[model samples]
Target: MSRTPDNWLLKVTGLTKIYGEPNENTLALTGPQFGSNICPETESIVACADINFELYPGEVLGIVGESGSGKSTVVKMLYFDIEKTYGEALLKPYANAGVNTLDESNQKKRYIRNHLMGMVYQNPRDGLNFNFTSGGNIAEKLIMAGNYHVGGIRERASELLVKTEVPVLRMDDRPSNFSGGMQQRVQISKAIANNPPLLFLDEVTTGLDVSVQAKVLDLIRELQHELGIAMIVVSHDLSVIRMLTDRTMVMKNGRIVESGLTDQILQDPQHAYSQLLVSSLL
Candidate 1:
């Protein structure tokens, strides 16, 4: 059956990834063996499989799953950090009506991934360069993405800092000097610097306190409403998903077990895993 397009800005179908099998023969000679059985030379494990989802413009799609359920892997594939083993990940451009499909062979896909998509990692430290000033870190992405003119770049970066609620006075300070919450705001500013059409937020508030998490979540909602940016938020926190997302997908062992409107899924979850997740939240 043909799938119906639901105002989708991004669509993923049957996505899968398997690692550590390509150089099995070479590894067999030098790699440590587990007893006489030789460890069977099995692949590491499938990080994700049969992953399918749709993200619409201005919609926050929450991907909630336990650790190792491939939530991060899905984000990596979307960001082109890793290649998918099978199936298609079609990113429909905001300006174009046609889908821009990606696979292992396309260099153009990488360019699009880097420019059109933005990612906020779980750890703010991973996303922001501690050595550089907060403004420099935010301006760096814009520069790399081809927004090279000094005047505009500086102005936009300063504006982004304001938008993300980071004080303009601290823009010259290194990320290491900022509080955790402030550093996270800097990271958010960096992610949104280019006004990307789609953004992947991988547990962006995991390490923050409740108040800070609330503030960050509110900022995300405000940005989404203002910019109409499509977002895929990978978070295990059910409350985060419920509060910020319009729709949600519940995953387990690299597969989606339940998906629907956020309220419906939370209020009347069908899958056992979904029920357990919801119960834990309550």
Candidate 2:
């Protein structure tokens, strides 16, 4: 595994968001701002607010919470899927320069996505191009990152497919022909095609069967360690957090209620909401 020597690969601070017209959105106050008391009928709803975290190279960080806890929103903002109302993130290679992704141009962001990071979504369709063959999907990422040789692209696709436990012979099949689990595996293969240093998994196992979920999670665990990549895993399942992440942050109503080692948070939750969440999982 080739790893950068950076202490913090990713650092986030004061991540916040609000939806709707400006002044109409409940006076636009900054939030510690986990959740809002103002009725949505009043106008603005806070999706996530004042969020902060630091991710070290080769470290796995888990953001776990119930639906609507703002976990997904944070990742969406980071990956540039949606615009953030406000926030800052500094990533390595760019760390010393302290570049916030939100401040980067679209072209630079595109370059970063293709060469520096990877993302796997819960819905395979969001990540996979159903019309493209499995190998083609992976090749797309490589091409965008500037690889041009057909032979090299195909060879790398086969390597990644095998690594992800997908059959190499199935490389030419379109994702539309795959089962949900297989499609997700293909997506994972594509995400890591560039051997990106940072990865994001958002609700990856949400719709898989239990056995399939286990295998997919195992693949993720093995690949992360093998590649020495830093990752942010977003899930509502605490079990997923326990199995994959080194540290866990418990979020509620769009705010992180508690953050600590996974074992510590699960075994000795301090926040009322976190306690309720853990107990409910019992």
Candidate 3:
């Protein structure tokens, strides 16, 4: 998809996440060049640094890297699951894209998360309430976004379940009773319950069986096409990235080493790290 400044749904600049106290040279000392995110000077961990990107509406952007490559950290910071040490992210639908979402107050951040964004984690437990029925989990998301009509909530929940290929008969069962794949489907349904423009998926199919993974990925593709929801998909699996994303960002040791059209990256990766990844995928 063609992306212009005015057409971007989300703009992120200089996004950095570091753990522990760090001095001025922390970021400089850690990255792909050093082959480590750990700063020798201050012992701080740079989960990600100087990340910049623009996600257009209805576009699927992929962050592909191996474990510890900081792909997940980027999305976690944007989703407010973790704090950013430095950076700014602006969502066009919020504050006319003038305010940095990372700087927003907690209450306002929650409001943005509830209404403008959604997340589906690799582990369903992190995203779903096992104690609640599958339908109830979706209900919680809807209710938080100000949906109070019980009948409407149920109707929407069932609709989402069916849309995601989850049997409506299982709606009343708790996540604990569902298979891993089923749990993920429920997680996805809840994530999109509010029809958020932006969604984040972090290694969502990592542990599923191969057949199950394909099903989940297919469902996700269907949802994206049907809802026109833009997504930031973080995955170590190149296949997952290849299957879902429009554009791709290759991360390694806390920095984006390469980024461009997914097909271009796959066919002719410029960065050595990215080349290694694409070659492995082939």
Candidate 4:
């Protein structure tokens, strides 16, 4: 893909993360035993290694992989929830401010999360505050972003609830009070509360039934098109990716094994892993 100087919304290069490195004493119940036969004595479990990808403005990049493929790890690193062991991540601003670099020391990632990036996790319960009402959750995000006016905050919350097709009447109810689908909608509302330039959706529809998943995917596509925001959708559901994303990247063992236009990848997969993934979807 040709990356324009101005069009790149996110850039990731040589990104890697290693956990439970040698010298630590973390133990496992049952696993292969190496030198010390201790979890911490083994070398790092490379969750992601030398990962490279770029997201352009208004594009949806689907990352498809099985369990332990590092999909969640990648998203977490992008959100700065976990510190990366190595590599660089840059976010291009929507206002032509140029690419801002993120790393362990610079802390630029935090700034991006606060103002430019948003995330929706696979489990809505994980993302939403159970104690807060749906409107309160959305309003909390706005307030955290520095908008303090009560009337304006409530108005925006109501508008977003409507945008996400969540009833305004349910706005005052806690997320725990809603059904799974409704809770997911509330999570989407909270994610877009700030109108972020980039969104990371980590299996947002994973546990929902097929019908509910379809509805949620449609809502995401509608929102993405309407807002012109860039998105990275990490999912194992090939059908969902095919329906929602512009392009797809197939990952295995912490590396991108194959990537191409969604249709092309589905029709003519280049890598063995991609072929297997595509075949399983069929």
Name the candidate that leads on TM-score: 3
Per-residue lDDT tens digits for candidate 1, residues 64-178, read 9998777899888878777777767776673353543554346666567557888888888888899899999988898878888888988998899999999898889999998
User: Per-residue error at 259 for model 2, in Å?
Assistant: 0.5
Superpose all Cα atoms of candidate 4 onto the true structure and report the RMSD in Å to 1 decimal: 4.8
Per-residue lDDT over 1-282 for candidate 2, one digit per residue giving the tens place of the 0 to 100 score: 233454678889999777765454453452335255233555566778788988888889999988877899988899989899888988876546378987899998898899988999999999988889999999999999999999999999999999998999999999999899999999999999998888999999999999999999999999987898899999999899989998899887677879998889889999888888789778
Shift in Å, residue 25, candidate 4 = 21
lDDT per residue for candidate 4 within 148-208, as digits (tens), equals 9999999999999999999999889999988788899999999999999889999998889
Against the true structure, candidate 2 has what lDDT? 0.86
Q: Where's the lowest-lDDT run of ten residues in candidate 3?
A: 1-10
Q: Higher-lDDT candidate among 1 and 3?
A: 3
lDDT of 3 by residue, 217-246 (tens): 999999999899999999999999999999
Question: What TM-score should be assigned to candidate 1?
Answer: 0.87
Error of 1 at 107 (Å): 5.0
User: Candidate 1 clashing pairs?
Assistant: none
Candidates 1 and 2, the one with greater lDDT: 2
As for TM-score, the candidate ahead, 1 or 2, is 2
Tell me how many residue pairs clash in candidate 2.
0
- Rank order (by lDDT, best first): 3, 2, 4, 1
Off by over 4 Å in 3: none
| Candidate 4 runs further than 4 Å off | 1-6, 22-43, 94-101, 104-108
Best by lDDT: 3
Q: TM-score, each model?
A: 0.87, 0.92, 0.98, 0.88
